[model samples]
Target: MDRIRIGLVGIGKIARDQHLPALNQGGDFDLAATASRNGRVDGVEAHETVDALIAARPDIAAISLCTPPAGRFEQAMAAIAAGRHVMLEKPPAATVSEAEALAEAARAKGVTLFATWHSREAAEVDAARGWLADKAIRAVRIMWREDIRQWHPGQDWILAPGGFGVFDPGINALSIATRILPDPLVVLSAELAIPENRACPIAATIAMRCGTAPVAVDFDFLQTGDQTWDIEVDTDAGTLYLRNGGSRLELPGAEPMQGPNAEYPRLYARFAELIRNGESDVDLRPLRLVADAFLTGQPTPAPAFEF
Candidate 1:
């Protein structure tokens, strides 16, 4: 089959690091064009805006948006309006309503809309989910911590009002939890540690529930030393652990399962399948859980953070 020509927007760090490499690998997609304000891929058509890319490359069948969540709704809507399949990065949009509207618009335009959670497509997430399917979950602990300076660099928007802050990475944990666990999760309470100089939290502690099991979450964006992105679950059968952001899994009676992180590749493959099958996959459970935490979280002041 001929590869589908696709345009990518927001050529930032993630685009350069993950999306470009994944798209370049053998897949159902060809990186036909890119739209970005300050970044570009060598030997590829580049445009300054999504509208320009769409106008210039009318044959591009799909558009993948890796832009920041704050202003992604407009770009996605524009792509959907042009009858192009759209794939969104995690969190989908800055707000739930915006994501919902994009989904509705895509459906109305009869194009595929895929809201991708890259972590949920990690090497062992499905295995973790399968193991917990028949077992009784007792408790879940999510500890996701990373240094913003190392990962995000000078991205000040991360601490801005619509940036999502620590939840940006924390939601990855929730995505895996919501996928692997059998029942829905509800946010009970959250303690958001906001930097004195920022609008969003630098760290957070959340209490949640899933089928009567307590789910505790700790999210930190200023963590130094070894970074942690792990989820542990206590079950009637035994304990299940997902390490390296779902790239590895450890179960009670089985040997450890480890694999290279192939999340973006899987995501692109899934996006292609969705477009070919005339389907849309937009799971909002993780986003909703974050929203609920914000709705009920109590804010506390922390020391000013600077990158």
Candidate 2:
């Protein structure tokens, strides 16, 4: 089969670090063009905007949108309307309603639409799910802490109203939790700690319930020591620990299992498969949990944060 010509929009950190490398390594996709205001990819035609890229590169069959969630809807809609398959970064859109709109547009145009959740494809996620398939889940705890200034730098969109704030990384945990847990869950309580200087929250504490099972998620940006992205589960069988953002898994008596670090590669492979099979993989459960936390969670003022 001929390689799918792909265009990339929003050449930010993720685009350079993950998307570009992944697409370059994947055999099913060829990076044909890119769109960005201040970033560019070597050896590819670059445009000032996604619209220009779409208009200029007619051969591009798919467009991977790496822009922040705030302005994802319009760009995604345009790509779908132009008959290009779309692969959206996590949190799909600024709002749940916008994501729904994009889904509708993709269906109307009969094109493949993939809402990419890189964390969901983490090496140990599937293993965690498999292990928990028959075991009774008693509780889940997540601790996702990182230095935003070191990670995001001057990216201002992450602090915007629809930027998702701490939920940006928090949603990844939610994605893994929702996928691995045996039963359906819903947000029971939440506390958002918004930086006084920013429009989005910098920290959040969320409590979720899956029937009788309870889950707690904590997202913090003040960690100065060894950055942590870990999830623990207390089950009737034993304790399960997923560390390094699902890269490694450890159960009661077993040693830590290491897995491949190819989330983006796997994502592109899935996208290619979806395109070839004429299917859409648009799961909104993770995004829904974030929205629920925003809608019903209490807001708390937090110390000023600088980047």
The TM-score of predicted model 2 comes to: 0.98
- Candidate 2 contains a number of clashing pairs equal to 0
Model number with the top lDDT: 1
lDDT of 2: 0.91
lDDT by residue for model 2 over 16-95, one digit each (tens)?
A: 88998898786799999999999988888999999999999899999999999888899999999999999999988998
Candidate 1 per-residue lDDT, tens place, 1-307, comes to 7789999999998898899999999799999999999999999999999999999999999999999999999999999999999999888999999999998998899999999999999999999999899998899999999999988999999899889999999989999999999999999999999999999999999999999999999999988999999999999999999999999999998899998889999999999999989999999999999999999999999999888
| TM-scores of the models, in the order given | 0.99, 0.98
Model 2, stretches more than 4 Å misplaced? none
lDDT of each: 0.94, 0.91
* lDDT score at residue 268, model 2, on the 0-100 scale: 96
lDDT score, candidate 2, position 266: 93
Candidate 1: TM-score? 0.99
